[model samples]
Target: MARYDVPAENHDRVLELLRQLAEASRAEPGNLAFDIFEDIDDPTRIVLLERYVSRDAFAAHRETDHFRDLVLGQIVPLLTSRTVEQLDAEDQ
Candidate 1:
């Protein structure tokens, strides 16, 4: 999961970039899911839920062109803050 606090002035652009990122990420062979959500109380606050086949797949995702360009190059600079967390599902 990832959370981003975007500046009010850059909200629209950030959202656009995120949409593009989601589309590209979901197309990756290693990606299982990619979802985006906005805070109702704070539109500038955004959350991303990403699921990959493995940790290696997640790492590869960060290295993808869309991730580097849209996320690192574009969206990151527009945010005031960002946080990421990694979680593993327990075996049933």
Candidate 2:
């Protein structure tokens, strides 16, 4: 899971960028899921539930142009704070 606190003043722009990022990530090979959600009480609080088939897949995702350029380069500047966690089930 990934959570982000983005600028409330630029809410729409931030949301748009996140949506674009989600779309691109979902289309990546080995991505099992990429879902986005927002806090009803606080629009600035965003959550992304991302899943990949394996650790290598996640690593490949981090190396992608869109992740580097759009997410790290573009979105990080718009965020006030962010947290990310990588998880896997025992079955994996």
Candidate 3:
């Protein structure tokens, strides 16, 4: 999971980019699920949820051009703050 706090100036762009990323991520070979959510109370806050078949699949996602070139290179710079964590599902 990941949480993004985008300043007002970058909110729209960040949200658009996240949605684009979510769409592209869903097409990845080992992706199980990809979701994006907006905070009800904070318009500038966004969250992402992702699941992969395995750690290798997740790593493959990070290595993709879309992930590396677009998300990391473009979108990341627009955020004021970001927090990401890896979680293990209770059962799969």
Best by TM-score: 1
The deviation in Å at residue 42 for candidate 3 is 0.5
For model 2, the stretches where C-alpha displacement exceeds 4 angstroms are 90-92
In terms of lDDT, which candidate is strongest? 1
TM-score, candidate 2, is 0.91
Count of residue pairs whose backbone atoms collide, per candidate: 0, 0, 0
Query: Mind giving the per-residue lDDT tens digits that candidate 3 earns over 1-92?
Result: 98988898988888788878888899999999999888899988988899999889998999998998768899989988889898887775
Where's the lowest-lDDT run of ten residues in candidate 2? 83-92
User: Which pairs of residues clash in candidate 2, taking residues 3 or more apart in a chain or in different chains?
Assistant: none
List, residue by residue over 9-58, the lDDT tens digit for candidate 2: 87788788878988999999989888989999999899989999998999
Better of 1 and 3 by lDDT: 1
Per-model TM-score versus the true fold: 0.94, 0.91, 0.92
- What C-alpha lDDT do the candidate models reach, one value each? 0.93, 0.89, 0.88
